[model samples]
Target: EPEVTQTPSHQVTQMGQEVILRCVPISNHLYFYWYRQILGQKVEFLVSFYNNEISEKSEIFDDQFSVERPDGSNFTLKIRSTKLEDSAMYFCASSEWTGELFFGEGSRLTVL
Candidate 1:
């Protein structure tokens, strides 16, 4: 079965810098989401998108963060400015509807 794929499996950046994480979700999935796990913490939802519009977003997704589907197959998340608190493992997920989600290996972000 085809799975979600993410680029830059690991990234390191300085505080106040910018970072962009990229993913290619399962081709047939309609809903996409970005979630993050900070160190040993639980996974936290950031945003959800469908039909080229943002369906829902958590408080963690502030003005500094943005998500885009630049083309048919790519979904991207951009962090305008990085912060030490933003260090986490970012996961890209997709689902055909609202049910099961297929997730990528995750891109670990480390901010110093």
Candidate 2:
């Protein structure tokens, strides 16, 4: 079965540099989302994009973050300025909301 793929499964970056996490979702999905889970917190939605516009976003998706669908198969999250607290498991998920979710293994971001 085809699934989402994220590069660097793990990334370590400095506290003030920009970092972009990449993902390739299932071929047929039209909706794309970014979510993160801090050490002991619940999964939180960052943003959702479709039809080339942001459908919705949570408070955590502040000015420091942005997302893009650069081509037919890639979705990317860019953080303009990293923070130590930015460390977490970034999950890329896709579904038509039929109550099922397919998630990427996750890209672990560790900022220092």
User: For model 1, where is the 10-residue window of minimal lDDT?
Assistant: 94-103
For 1-112, candidate 2 gives per-residue lDDT tens digits of 9898887799999999999999998888888889999989999999987877788999999999999999878989999999999999999887665246678999999999
Best by TM-score: 1
Predicted candidate 1 versus true structure: per-residue lDDT over 20-84, tens digit per residue: 99999999999999999999999999999999989999999999999999998999999999999
- What residue runs in model 1 are displaced by over 4 Å at the alpha carbon? none
What RMSD, rounded to one decimal, does every model reach? Answer: 0.5, 1.2
The lDDT per prediction is: 0.97, 0.89
Model 1 quality (TM-score):
0.98
Candidate 2 regions off by >4 Å?
Answer: 97-99
Judge candidate 2 against the unseen true structure and give its global Cα lDDT, from 0 to 1. 0.89
